[model samples]
Each structure stands twice: as structure tokens, then as C-alpha cells.
Target: MSVTKKVILITGGSSGIGKAVGIYLSQKGYIVYGTTRNVANYSNFIHFPLLTLDVTKTDTIKKAVNDLIAKEGRIDVLVNNAGVGITGPVEEIPDNEICNHFETNYFGAIKVMKGVLPQMRKQKTGLIINVTSIAGYMGLPFRGVYSASKAALEVTTEAIRMEVMSFGIKVANLAPGDFATNIAGGRYHAPVIEGSDYQKNYQMSLDLMDAHVDDGGDPKEVGIIIEKIIQTPNPRIHYKVGAFMQKFSVFLKRILPDKTYEKLLLNHYKL
Candidate 1:
């Protein structure tokens, strides 16, 4: 590994914010590798190497991390960005789908961290940036499952950061707002079944969510923030990048009463 250029591994880098960040880092001369479940689909990918990784599977996670270590000799940074989205009323969402959302967004990120920590410990210095969401700050209407999954990672990141501090490993969560990504298309949504109690409200929230993503900011800005965070000698445990109202909503939650916040959210979603 080149002393001046760090090796970065970003999971779920095939598209969206992950791809944006990976490409930005690679363009600036960092040695970068992005991961996707199916590599054959990206045979001609030119931005940086896209390795085979399926965060849902432990075997694939180990292989990707080990192979990168073998080739690079050290893994300096890991952006645990692989995750899926689920939308619908919490009660209406199927149990399996809720489990699957956590499987990839929560457990999968943990597995990847487990795979890389050994090498980072050996090096005595490394950084892991877990990509969470601004939504994780609060329970959003129709996005409850996705919110919970990211929130789980957020709290876990806080706990693990302390556990590994003595080893010289720094962990942080990057919570991004909508970023004009393909997440909406890939997101799982419970059918808007007619006459169901949640049918009308769920549809309203779903449409609002789609519009937010469609009007999201450039994802490369997140890459820029990642670069800054990597440069900081000691990075904070939490970082958020998004529109003013989106970030402000977090502040509101802290100061307002519980029901007050709930009312505000209900109003925003027009429920």
C-alpha cells in the first residue's frame, strides 16, 4: 500500500451515495474499492474496482474484506454504506420484510466491521464510517422500519466507538438526508390495499417520501464531507448532511415534548 494514499472500502457502492463517494475518492488518487452483490453486472465499471460482497451473507462479507486486505496489505477506511429501504405503516409491514431490512442495514454492517477490525487493530489506526440516515434521528411516518434499522446502527456505532478506542480505531455514523438516489425504486412498500385503515395515510406519506428523494441534493457533497472527516485528527461520533429542515427536525425532537414532536411529524406528513 502506498503510504500517502489510503485504501478505502465502501459497501453498496454500485449506485447512489456510495458510488458517488467512492468515485470522488478514487478521482482524488485514493485506492478505492466498492462492493456489490453481483460483480458480473459491473464488469466494465471504470471508476474503481467493484468487489463481490453480499452483506446479507457472512461468507461473502469475510471474502471481500480478506481479499481486499490480501491485495492492499492493509485496510485503512471502511464506509459501511450498504443498506435497503422499506416503507409502509409499521403494522402493515410484513414480519419477514422488517427482518430483512434489519438483516442488511444493521447486522450486515456489523459483520463487515467484524471482518475488517482485525486488520485495523494490527495497523493500530483506522476509521469506519457507518452510513446511517437523518431519518434515524426520529421515527418517520411510513418509513418506520427503515428508520429503526438505521437508528439501531447509530446507537451501535456509538457503543463500538468506545469499545475500540484503545485500539486506535475511530468509528462514526454519517446520517444523510435524501440524495437523489435510486433508493425509492429499490425500496419495498406494502401494497396500498383499499379500505385498509392505513391505506390513505400510508399513500400520502409514500408520495411525500418519493418527492423528497427526487428533489435531494447532490450526493458527492457527502463524499466531500467524508474527506473532511477522514482528515480530522479526531472525528465526532455523529455527522449529518442534508437540507436545513431535515437536520433541524432532529433539533426539534430534542427540545420539544414527545407528543409535540409527534404532532409536528404528523402535520409534516399530512396524516
Candidate 2:
């Protein structure tokens, strides 16, 4: 019997890492369906079909998944790549803004997962790759909210991996560090009050964040990693992709003393 080509669904595919993955996977012969909030605007730009999806909206998430399944009959892989970043001092960050960050970065992913799980459960085979960040592992100085949001997703991904293993559904967290993308343009800056204690430090940290992204690793590298993961029958649970120093930081966080790790992080960020 000939193996059927897998149907893959990727969220936030209008640009950045998600767009690269969609283009690469579609070129590799898989039926790739990418989701974007403004499909009308992005439809002409992307190579593959673009589904209208706003991850924070449950109705849109459902419609996007249903539309893909109605046409393709199955969604073999789901990449939860949709997320937003919020930056500033934790104390000054508004509650609603923090909620918004979680809504898009964490809860939005959960909504998409719920939308696709039933079909994968019925088919008894599937793969879920959550595109998280190295910041998820360690909270950055100004990007605390963004880090916390990804960290929440990382923990949730672990739980889902165990829960779905019995149903032949494999789950993995893809942690990337500082990729060249338009993420800075989309990031929300917390309101900084005049004379606030964290003003100078926050500005310095924010500038460093932007510089890291500007000089970051190529996002195509991440796309290549996603393609490989899609082809693997039994993939590992966690994959960290990025520069050697970033990957090593994760390892160091695990082994170093709390104070020692804090010093290392401080030195790296020039804090």
C-alpha cells in the first residue's frame, strides 16, 4: 500500500518561523495549510493555502481546523506557532496586558490543540510541535511576561505529551532562541511611568532584546528542523534549536547553582 502524504497545519504562518516552515514543508510535498489572521492580505504572498485563523478566537480556530479537515480528511501534524510577546517590568505591566499575552501565547495554542485533537484521536496517529522560546526556560529581565507565557506553554506541552501518548499522538516542544524575524514589531511594551524604578534598566534590556533578534540565527534553520521532525516516526519530546551559546544556556540553567546561574544571565544581558 502506498503511504498517503501527510496534511500539516501551521498557525501564525504569515511570517517569521512559521512562514518559513510552511514554505519548506509544502515544497517537500506535504499538503501544508497555513493560518493567518489577515488571509486576504497574505494569501497572495504565501506559496501554500492560507486559512483565516485568529488563535485567540475560538470560533476562528474551529473554523480553520474544520475547513482543513473537510478538504484533506486528516491533519497529520499541528504546529502551535502562534504567540505574542509583552515586555517591561513585571510590577508595571498591566493585568489586562499580561492576560493578553497569555491569551495569545498560551491559551491560543490550547484552543488550536483542542480543535485538532478529536480528529487525531479518531485516526490514532498525530504529532504536535509547540514552537516555544529559550526565554520560556529562563525569565529575561524586561521580557518577563513573554517568558512566563512560553514557560506556561512548555509545562502544558509536557502534560499533553503524557496524556496523548496512549492515543498514538506524539507531542514535542521546540524551543528556539533569538531568530531573525519581525517579532520586535509585534511585541507589546508595558506602560513605563516617568520616574519608575525600572525605567533605565528596562530600556537597556529592551534594546538588547532587539539587538539579539536583529543579529539572531536564521529562521530557515528552524524551518529545516521542523521538516525533519515531521518526517520522524518517533521523535524526541524536546528539541532546542539555535546558536551554541543559547542551547548551552539551557543546560547551564539545569546544572548551575541558583546564584551562579543568575550571575551568568546578568553578565550575558549586561545587567
- Model 2, position 86, has a per-residue lDDT of 85
191-262 per-residue lDDT for model 2 (tens digits)? 666798887778888888899899998898887898888778888878989999999999999999999999
Query: For model 1, what is the alpha-carbon lDDT of residue 12?
Result: 97
Q: In lDDT terms, which candidate is top?
A: 1
Candidate 2 global lDDT: 0.89
- What TM-scores do the predictions have? 0.98, 0.96
The count of residue-pair clashes in candidate 1 stands at: 0
lDDT for model 1, please: 0.93
For each candidate, how many residue pairs have backbone atoms clashing (under 3 Å)?
0, 0
Local distance difference test scores for all models: 0.93, 0.89
Best by TM-score: 1
